[model samples]
Target chain A: MTSVRQRLVPYWLLAPGLIWLIVFFVIPMYYMGELSLKTGSIDTGYQLTWAFSNYTDAISQYSTQFFRAFYYAGVATLLCLLIGYPLAYAIAFKAGRWKNLMLFAVVAPFFTTYLIRTIAWKTILDDSSPVVSFLKTIHLVPQDGRVLATSAAVIAGLTYNFLPFMVLPLFAALERVDIRLLEAGKDLYASATQTFLRITLPITMPGIVAGVLLTFIPASGDYVNATFLGGTNQAMIGNVIQSKYLVVRDYSEAAALSFTLMAIILVALIVYIKFAGTEALMGDEEEAE
Target chain B: MEGSSDLPPTDPESDQPGETAGNTARSGSGGVRLEGVTKKFGDFAAVHDMDLDIADGEFFTMLGPSGCGKTTTLRMIAGFEQPTTGKVLIDGSDVAGLPAYKRPTNTVFQSYALFPHMTLEENVGFGLKRQKVPKAEIKKRVAGELERVGLSREAKRKPNQLSGGQQQRVALARALVNLPKVLLLDEPLGALDLKLRKGLQVQLKEIQRDVGITFVYVTHDQEEALTMSDRIAVMNEGMIEQCADPETVYDRPSTTFVAGFIGVSNLMPAVAKGPGEIEIADGPTVPTADAAQFSSGEKCFAVVRPEKLTVSLPENAPGDQPGIDGIVESSLYLGTSTQMAIKVADDVNMTVLVPNASEDARQHLPGGGAKVRLNWLPEHMHLVAESDPGGSDADQTSTDQVTEGVNS
Candidate 1:
C-alpha cells in the first residue's frame, strides 16, 4: 500500500501540468488542424468543405519562401553546432572550478527579452555605426556592402538567437562524458586528438543532433530576425505566413501554410529521431558515463 | 572446447610479458620501487612519503580503509597521479612527471571505464591499435586477448550487452593486451554483488597466477586482499601501518588500528600488570608478553580476536583458569557457523564465532545476560599503545578521510 501510494504520487503531481498542456496547447493544435480543413464564405459562419485544395494552394504559392527559410535555418543550425560544440567542450572538460561561472555567463544574455535583444542587434550592426566603420578599417567587414540587411544577416540573427539551445545540450552532453573514458582512451593508446575524435565526439553526437533540431525549427519559423535583419530579398517563410494572415487577410491560405510547415517538420523529426535517438548509440555512452 | 574461442581465463602474475611492458621506465628490470612517494592535493596529503619494493611478478595489494591512500599510491604507480615528492620506479627509471599514457603501466579502474562505442574486440585491440600495430598483428593480438579473457566469441558485442563479470574481463583484457610491466587494479570487484565478488576474488587470484604479471591491487576489503595478494600493505592516514603476509598481518598487527581493522578483534583496557600479564576491565588478570613495552601501571590495550577466545561455563572450564564471565546476548545463525554477542564488561560487547549450533534457546538470564567465561591464550592479545584510558575520542573521529583519499 505504501509503495502504491509512492508510485501514485508522481502521477498525481503530473496530472495538473498534463491537463493544462492538453487543454491549452494540444487542443489548439487540434483546432488548428480542423481549421486547416475548412472553407469559409465570410458570411456563412464557416462550413467544413473538407477541400484538399487548401494544402496544394499553400504549397504552389509559397514554395520559394518555404525553401529559402529552410535553407537559412539549416545554415544557422550548422553554424550553432560549429560554435557551441567547441565552447561546450572547453567549458565542460577544461574550465574546471570556473564551470558554474561560465555557465551563468552563457545564461546571462538569455534573461533579456528576445525581441529587445534582437532589436539591440540592429543598432550594433548599423552600417554607419563606428563599430562597423572600425571593422571596415581593419578589412574585416566588407566595405562595399552593408551587413544590416542581407541574407547573411538573417542567418547570423537566427544563429545568435538560438545559440543557447545549442549550447545547453552540448554542455550537458560534454559534461557527462566520463573523464575515465578519456583516460582509458589515452591508456589504450589513443592520442589526445584520436580520443576526442573517436570517443568524445561519438558519445556526444546525440546532443549535437538535438541542438540542431532545437535551433533549426525555431529559426525557420522566426519572422522577428527576418524582419529586423533581412530586407525584402530575405524575408523567411515566417514573414510570408504573417503577411498572409495580417497584411493580406488570407486566413485560409495562412492556416494551410502553417499545416504544411508542421507536416514537413514532423517528417523531418521522424527522420532525425530515426538516426539520432535509440539507434544513435547515445544511451550506451550514458550508461558508462 | 567448442566455445574455446571465448575469453580465456587468466592469472596475470604467472605470465611474464617484459620489463618495459607493464613496468614503467623507472622499473626497467621488472621490480617496482617507490622512493619517498608523496601525493599532496594542495596542503592535504593523500599519500605520505611511501617507500615500497614489490617483487617482480608478485600479487601485491595495498589494503586499507576507504581513505588510507592505497589507491593514491596505486594511481601514482600507474602514472595517473604523479607523486608530489618521491619517484615511482617500475624497473629502474623514474616516472615522476610522465602522464598515464606515457607510462608502461595500465589500470583496471573500479568503474571498468570501457569504451561503449567499441565492441569487445575493438576495446581489447585498442591499446595495440594505438601503437599502430600491423593490421594482421592487431587482429591476431585482439583475438588472443579476447581469448585470454574468455570473451573471444563475444568480441562483436558491446560492453552493455555483457554481464558485469564479462565487462570486467574485457577491462582486464584491455589492460593485459598492453602487456604493461605492472597491472594496477583499483577495487576492480567493487561494483559486483557479494556472491559475484567472492567468485571474482578467486578468479582474480587464479588469473594472476596464470599470467605472472606484477599485480598491484588496491582495496579496502581485507578478505579480497588476503586471498589474492602475496604481500598486503595495510595503510592508514596516508601511511603504511604494516606490510606483510596476510597471516602475519592478521596474527600480529603492529598497531591498535591494524588489529581493529583486519578482523573482529576484541579490544579491552588493560595495564601492564607484569611482563606478560595485565589487569583487564571486569575480568581476571590476563598474561600477554607482547605488550611489555609499557612500564607497569601505564595504560595500554589488549587486542585479541574473537575466534581466539574460548567460551564455556565455569564448571566445564579448565581448573583455576582466569576468564571474563558474560552472557550470550544474541545468537546469529550464519549457515555452517553461529555468532553470539556477549556482554563481558558491563555494557561492553564482544562477538564470538562458534562453529556448533545450540540445541535449545538458553535465554533464561535477564536481558540474555548469563554467567559465561571468556578464555584465550596469552599470545592472542596484542598490546596497543592507548593515548587515553577511555578511548572514547579515538572512536569518535573515524579514519574515513584517509580511506577516501586513497579510493576516491
Candidate 2:
C-alpha cells in the first residue's frame, strides 16, 4: 500500500502545474480553434456553423499581409544574425576576464518594460531628435527625414528588440565549444579563418537556428513595432489579425489567422528539428554528456 | 626536433631508446623554453617564475596537486595564458605575444571537444580544410591520421557515437594531424576509469614514441606521469619542486612535498646526534645520511620507505644489527606482497612490506604492542627538515583556506 502511495505522490506533486497548463493552454487553444469555424458579426453573438471556408477566406483576403510579415520577419532575423554572431563570438571567446560583465550588459536592457523601451526608440527616431541630427551628420539620415512609420524603421525596431535573444543563444552555443577542438583545428594546419568557417560556424548552427526561431516568431507576432514605427506599407501579420477583429468585426477570421500563424510556426519548428537534429537542440547537459 | 615533418608517425622498433630521450635538436630540442615564467591572476600567483626546457620530442609530464602550477605551466607553453613576467619560446623562437592558433603547439584538452556535427574524418580534416588544403590532400591526411590513432574504421562516425577511449584517440589524431612541434595534453586521461586509464597510458606513451613530437602532458596522477613521461616535473605551490627521471624522482626527492606527493614514505622527526649518526627516539644511533647537509643540533626528518624496512623477530635478527621495536597492527595480502602497519613507539606506526615468496616466512604477525624489530640499510635513511611533512604551517593552512573558499 505504501509503495502504491509513493507512486501516487509524484502525480500529487505534479498536479497543480499540470492543471495550470491544461486550463491556460489546452482549453484556450481548443476554444480558439472551434471559434475559427464559427462566424461572429456585430449584430449577432458568436455562433458555430462548422464553416471551414472561414480559414480559406481569411487566407485569401490576407495572403499579401501574411507573406509580407514572414518576409519581413525573415529579413529581420537575418539582420539579427549578421549583427549578433560576431558580438556573441567576441563575448564568448575573446572577452576573458570581462565575459560575465559583457553577458550582463547584453541582458541588461531586458530588465525594463519592453513596451517602454520600444517607445524610447520611437522618440529617438523623431526628425528633430539628436540621434537623427547625428545620423544626418554621418549621411545616414536625410534632411527633413522621419524614420517613424517607415518600413526600415520597423525592421530596425524588430532587429533591436530581438538582438539580445539572438546574441544569448549564439553566445551559449559558442561558449560550449571545447577549446581543444579549436586547438586541434589550428594544429591540423588550419589557418584561423579556416578554423572559424569549418569548425566554429558549423558547430554553432544550432544556436543560429534557435536565434532565428526566437527572432522571426516574435517579430511576426509583434504589432507594436508596426503600429509605432511601421507605416501602412509595412504592416505585419499581427496588424492583419488586429484589423480583422476590430475594423471588420470578424472574430472568426481573426481566429482562423491566429491558428494559421501557429501552424506555420509549428511547421518551421518541425523542419528545423528535422534538419538540425533534435539532439543538437536539447538542453546543454544532454548535449555535453 | 627529431622526426620527419611529412611522413606518417609510427613506433619504429629501432628508435625506442632515443625516442625516450627526445633529443630531436634538428628542429633542435628548443620546442618550448620557459624562462622565469610567472602568471598572476590578481594577487594570487598560479605559476611563479617557472623555468624549464622542454625538448622537441620529449614526452614530459608536469604533475602536482589540483591547485599547483602544472596546468598553468602547460598553458604558458601553449600560448593560451600569458606569463606575467617571463618569456615563452617555441621552437627556439620567442612567441611571447603569439596567440594559441599562431603557436607551433597543439593541445589535446581534457575534454576531447570533438565537433558534434562532423564525422570523425571531417573533424580530423577540419584544420587542413581551414588552411585551404586541397580537399583531396585533406582527405588523404585525415585518413592517415585516423589510421595512426587506430580509428580508420570509425572515420565515418561522429564523436558522440564513439566510445570515450575512441573519442580520446580521435582528439589525439586531430592534434597530431596538424604536425605541431609541441603537443600539450592537459590531464587528457583524467576522465577515464582506472582500467581504461592504464590502457591509454600505454597508448599515449607509444604514440609519443611514434610521433617523435615534444609532448607536454599535465596530470595530477603520478602513476600516469611516471609511466608515460620521459621526465616528470613534480610541482607544488606554483613551483617545480623536482624535475627528473621517474626512478630518480621517486628514489631521491629533494623536498618533502616531492617525497610525499610522488610515493609513500614514513616521514619521522629525528634529532641530529652526531656525524653519520642520528637518534630517532630513545634508540641506538640510526645510520645518518649526509650529516654535513645539516647542523648537528638542528631538527631533521628521517624517511623510511615501507619496502626498504625489513620486519623480523628479535631472535631471528642479525645479532649486531640495530632496528626499531614494533608490533604488527594489521596485515593485508595484496596479491604479490604482504603489507603490514606496525606500531613502533607510542601511537606512531610504520608500514612494512614483505615479498610474497614462499621462502619468506608468512609469520603470523602479532597485533598491537607485540614486540618486533624494524631494520633498514644505512644508506636508505634520508634526512630533511622536520617541518617537511606538514610543510610550513602558514602555507599549509592558507592552502586549506584557499580550498575551503574564495572571496569570489
Candidate 3:
C-alpha cells in the first residue's frame, strides 16, 4: 500500500497543470474543430454537417491576405534579429558593470501597454512629423509622400514591438558561452571574425531559432499593427478574420479560416525545425557534463 | 602508427625545420624567450620583471601555488596577454605586435575548453582549417591526431558526450595538430583525479618527446613538475625563487620559500655560528652545508628533508652524527612510511619520516609522548636564506591581485 501511494505521488503533483491544460486547451480545440466543419449563419445556429467547402472557400477568397501576413511577419522577424543580436551580444560579453542596466533598458518599453505603444507610432510617423520630414529631406521619402499608413509602417511597428523577445533569449544563450572557448579558438589560430562565425554563431543558434519563432508567430496573427498603421491595401489575414467574425457574422468561415491559418503555421514550423536540427533543442542536455 | 607520421620530424638540434641559419644567431636556439617581461593590472603587478629562455624540445614547467604568476607568464608566451614592458620572442624573432592567432605558439587551456558543439574531428581540425590547409590534408591530419590521442573511435562525438579525461585528450590533440613552435600548457591536468593525473603526466611527457616541440607547462602540483619537467622554475609572489633541474631543486632549494613549497621540510630558525655551523634557536648548534655564505650571527633557516632524519633511542643514537632530542607529539601511519611530529622546542616542531620496511620497524616505532633522538648526517643539512619580514602581507596582496586579474 505504501509503494502504491508513493507511485501515485507524481500523478498527484501533476494533477493541477494537467487539469488546467485539458480544460482550457483540449476542450476549446475540440469545439473549434467542430465549429470549423459546421455550416450555418449566426442567426440560424450552426450545425455540424461536415461542410468541407467552408475551408476551400476561405482559402480561395483570402489567399492574398495570407501571403501578405506571412511576408510581413517574415520581414519583421529578420529585422528584429538584425537589430537585437548585437545589442544582446554587447550586453552579455562587453558591458562590464553596466550589463544589468542595459538589459533593463531593453525591456523598458514593455511598461507601456502594447496597444498604446502601437498607437504612439501613428503620431511619430505622421505626414508632417519631424521623422517623415527628415526622411523627405534626405530623399528617402519623396517630397509628396507620407509614412503614416504603409507596409513599412506596419513592419516597423511589428519589429519594435517584438524586438525584446529576440534580445532576451539571445542574451541568455550568449551569456552561457564560455569565455575560455573563445580563447581556445584564438589559440587554435582562428582570427577574430572567423572565431565569431565558426564558434560563437553556431553555439548561439538555438537562441536564434527561438527568437525567430517568438517574433514571427505573434506578428503573423496580430491585427492591431495593421489596423493602426497599414492602409486598406495592406490588410492582412488577421484583419479579414476579424471582420469575418464581427462584421460579416460568418461564424463558420471564421472558424475555418482560423484552422487554416493554424495548419499552415504548424506545417511551416515543422519544416523550419527540420532544417534547423532538433539537436539544438536537445543540445542543452549535454552541457552539464 | 600512421599517426606518428604527422609529427614534425625530430631535428635533434633545432626542433623546427624551416628556420634559416641566420635566424638562430641571437638566441642560439629555436624556442621561446622573454626579456624583462612584466604584466600589471592597474597598479598591482601580476608578473614582475621576468626573464626566461626555453630551449627547443625541452619539457619545462613553472611550478607554484595559486596567485604565483605562473599562469600569467604562460599567457604572455602564448600571446593571450601582452607583457606590459617587455618583448616575447618565438623562434628567435620578436612577436611584440602579433596576435595570439598569428603567433607560432598554442595553449592547452586549463579548463579543456573544447568546442562543445563540434565533433572531436572538427575540434582537432579547427587550427588547420584556419590555416587554410587543403581539405584532404586536413582530414588526414585530423584522423592522425585523433588516433594519436586514442580517440579515433569517438571522432564523431561532441565534447560533452566524452568523459573529462577524453575531452582533455581532445584538447591536447587539437593544439598539437597545428605543430606549433612552442606549446604552452596552463595546468592542463589540474582538473583530473589523482590516478588519472599521474597517468596523463607520463603520457604527456612521452608525447612531448615524440613531437620534439618546446613545451612550457604551468602547474601547482610539485610532484607533477618533478615527474615531467626537464627543468622547473619554482615561483612565488610574482617572481621565481629558483629555476633548476628536478634533483637540484629537491636537494638544494635556494630560499626558505622554495624549500617549504616543493616538499615537506623541517625548517628550524637558526643563527649562523661560523663557516660550517648554525646554532638552532632554543636548541643545539648543527653542522650545515653552505654555512660559509652567511656571516656570523646572521639569521637563517636550517633545512632538512623529513626522510633524511632517523629516530632512535637516545642510547642507540650514533655518536658521530649530529642529533637533537625531542618528544614525539604524534605519529601518522602512511603505509610506506611512518611520519612522526617531534616537539624539539617550545615553539618549534620537526617532522621525521621512518621507512616501514619490516614488521620489526613498525613495532619499534615510537608513539606519542615517547622521547627519541633525531639523527642525520652533517651533509644532509642545508641552510636557506631568511624569509621576508613582510611575507604574510605580500601573500595577502597577491591573492587580491589574483582576484583582480580574474575580474578584468
Candidate 4:
C-alpha cells in the first residue's frame, strides 16, 4: 500500500496546477473555439452555425494588419536581443561588486505602471522635445521629420517594454557558465572572439530561444503600443481584434481572428523549435541537475 | 641549492646531470624561465619575486599548501596572467605581450573545464581546429589522442556523460593534443578519490615520460608530488622555501616550513649550545648533525622524523645511546606501523612510529600512559632555522584557511 501511495505522489503534487490549467485555460479555449465557428452579432442573438468562413473572412479583411503586427514584433524582438545581450553579459561577468546594483537598475522601471511608462516615451519623443531636435541635428531625422506616432515610436516602445524579459534569461544562462571554461578556451589556442562564439554563445543558446518567445508572443498580440504610439498606418492585427470585439461588436469575427493568430503562432513556434532543436530547451534542465 | 645538486641522476639517458639546476643560467634551452616574476592583486601579493627554471622534458612540480602562489605562478607561465614586473620566457623566447591563445603553453585546469556542449572528440580537437590544422589531420590526431587516454570509445559522448576520472583524462588529452612546449597542470587529480588518484598519478608520470614535454604541475598533496615529480619546489607564503628531488625534499628539508609541510616532523624547540649539541626546551640536551651551521646560543628546532625515533620501555632503553625520556600518551595502530604520541616535555609532544613486522613486535610495543624512552642516532637530529611567521604550524586550522582563500 505504501509503495502504491508513493507512485501516486507525483500526480498528487501536480493536482493544483492541473486543476488551474483546466479551469482557466482549457475551458476558455473550448468556448473560444465554439464562438469562432458561430454566426453572431450584438443585436441578433448569437448561434453556433458552424460557419468556417468566419476565419477566412477575418484573415482576408485584416491581412495587412496581421503582416504589420508580425513584422513590428519580429523587429522589436531582434532589437531587444542585440541590446540586451551585451547588457546581460556585462552584468553577469564584468559588473563585479556592482552586479546587484546594475541588475536592480535593469528592473527598476517595473516599479512604475507599464501604461504610464509607455506614455512617458510619448513626451520624450515629441517633435518639440530635445530628443527629436538632437536627431534632427544629427540628420537621423530630417528637419521636418517627427518621431511621435510613427512606426519607429511603436517599435521602440515594444522593444523597451520587453527588454527585461530578454535580459533576465540571458543573465541566468551566462551566470551558470563556469569561468574556467573560458580560460581553457584561451589555453587551447582560441582567440577571445573565437571563445565567445564557440563557447559562451553556444552555452547560452537556451536563454536566447526563451527570450525571443517571451518578447515576440505578447508583442504580436498587444494593441496598447499601437493605440498610443502608432497612427492608422502603424496599426496591427491587435487593433483590428479590439475594434471588432468592442467597437463593431462582431463577436464571431473577433473570436475567429483570435484563433487564427494563435494557430499561426503555434505553427511558427513548431517550425522554430524544429530548426533550433528541442535539445536547447532540454539543456536548461541538464544544467539544473 | 645543495638540495638540487644532491639529486640522483633521474633520467639515466639524459646527457647532463646538472640540467635540472634552477641557477644554471642555461637560458633559451627549450624550457620555461621566470625572472623576478611577481603578481600583486591590489595590496595583496599572490606571488613575489620568483625566479625559477624548468628544464626541457623535466617533470617539475610546485608543491605547497593552499594560498602559496603555486597556481598564480603556473598561470603566469601559461600566459593567462602577466607578471607585474618580470619576463616569462618559454623555449628561450620572451613572451610578455603575447596572449594565452598565441603562447606555446597549455594548461589543465583543476576543475577539468571540458566544454559541456561539445562531444569528447570536438573538445580534444578544439586546439587543432583553432590552429587551422587540416580537417583530416584533426580527425586523425583527435582519434589518436583519445585512444591514448583510453577514451576513444566515448568520443561521441558529451563531458557530462563520462565519469569524473574519465573527464580528467579527456582534459589531459585536450591539452596534450596541442603538443605545447610547456604543459601546466593545476592539481588535475585533486577531485578524484584516493584510489583513483593514486592510479592516475602513476599514469600521469608515464605519460610525461612518453611525451618528453616540460610538465610544470601544481598540487598540495605531498605524496603525489613525491611520487611523480623529477624535482619538487616546495613553496610557502608567495615564495619557494626549497626546491629539490623528492628524496632530498623528504629526507633533508632545508627550512622548518618545508619540513612541516612535506611530512610529519617533530620540531622540538631547542637552543644550539656548541658544536654538535642543542638543548631542547625543558628537556635533555641532544646531539644534532648541523650544529656548526648555527652560532652558539642560537634558537633553532631539533627536527626529527617520526619513523627515525624508536620507542621502548624506560627500563629496557640502551645505556650508551643519548635519548629522551617521555610518557606515552596514546598508541594508534596504522596498517603497516604503530604510531605513539609521547610527551617528552611539559608542553612538547613527540610522535614515534614503530614498524609492525610481526605479532611479537606488536606485543612488545608500549601502550597509553606508559613511561618510555625515545632513542635515535646522533645523525637523525637535524637543526633548522626557527619557524617563520605563517610557516610553522601545518595543522588542520591553517589548511582550512588557505583552502578558503584559494576557493574564494
TM-score on 0 to 1 scale for chain A of candidate 1 = 0.90
For candidate 1, lDDT tens digit of each residue in A18-131? 999999989988877777778874455556778678889889878988999999999999999999998999999889899999989888888899999888888878898887
Q: Model 3 over residues A1-289: C-alpha lDDT tens digits?
A: 9999999999999999999999999999899889989998888899999999999998999999999999999999999999999999999999999999999999999999999999999889989799999999999999988887799999999999999999998998899898899999998889999999999999998889889999999899889899999999889999999999899989888889999999999999999989998877445635554
Query: What TM-score, over all chains together, does every model reach?
Result: 0.82, 0.82, 0.93, 0.92
Error of 4 at A105 (Å): 1.8
Candidates 1 and 2: which is better by TM-score? 2
lDDT for A222 in candidate 4 is 86
Model 1, residue B268: C-alpha shift (Å): 3.8
Give the winner by TM-score.
Answer: 3
Which regions of candidate 4 are displaced past 4 Å?
A1-12, A284-289, B1-29, B395-408
Interface root mean square deviation for model 1, in Å?
A: 3.2
Tens digits of per-residue lDDT for model 4, B45-90: 8998999988998999999888989999999988888999888999
What ranking emerges by lDDT with the best candidate at the front?
4, 3, 1, 2
Question: Which pairs clash (backbone N, Cα, C closer than 3 Å) in model 2?
Answer: A187-B178, A188-B178, B1-B24, B25-B28, B25-B29
Candidate 3: TM-score of chain A is 0.96
Best by lDDT: 4
Fraction of native Cα contacts kept in each candidate? Answer: 0.63, 0.50, 0.87, 0.80
lDDT of 3 at B99: 87
Off by over 4 Å in 1: A1-64, A90-101, A251-256, A275-277, A281-289, B1-29, B271-299, B319-331, B341-351, B357-368, B378-381, B384-408
**Ranking of all candidate structures by their TM-score, best first:** 3, 4, 2, 1
True-vs-predicted CA distance for residue A23, candidate 1, Å:
7.0
Local error of candidate 3 at residue B292 (angstroms): 1.1
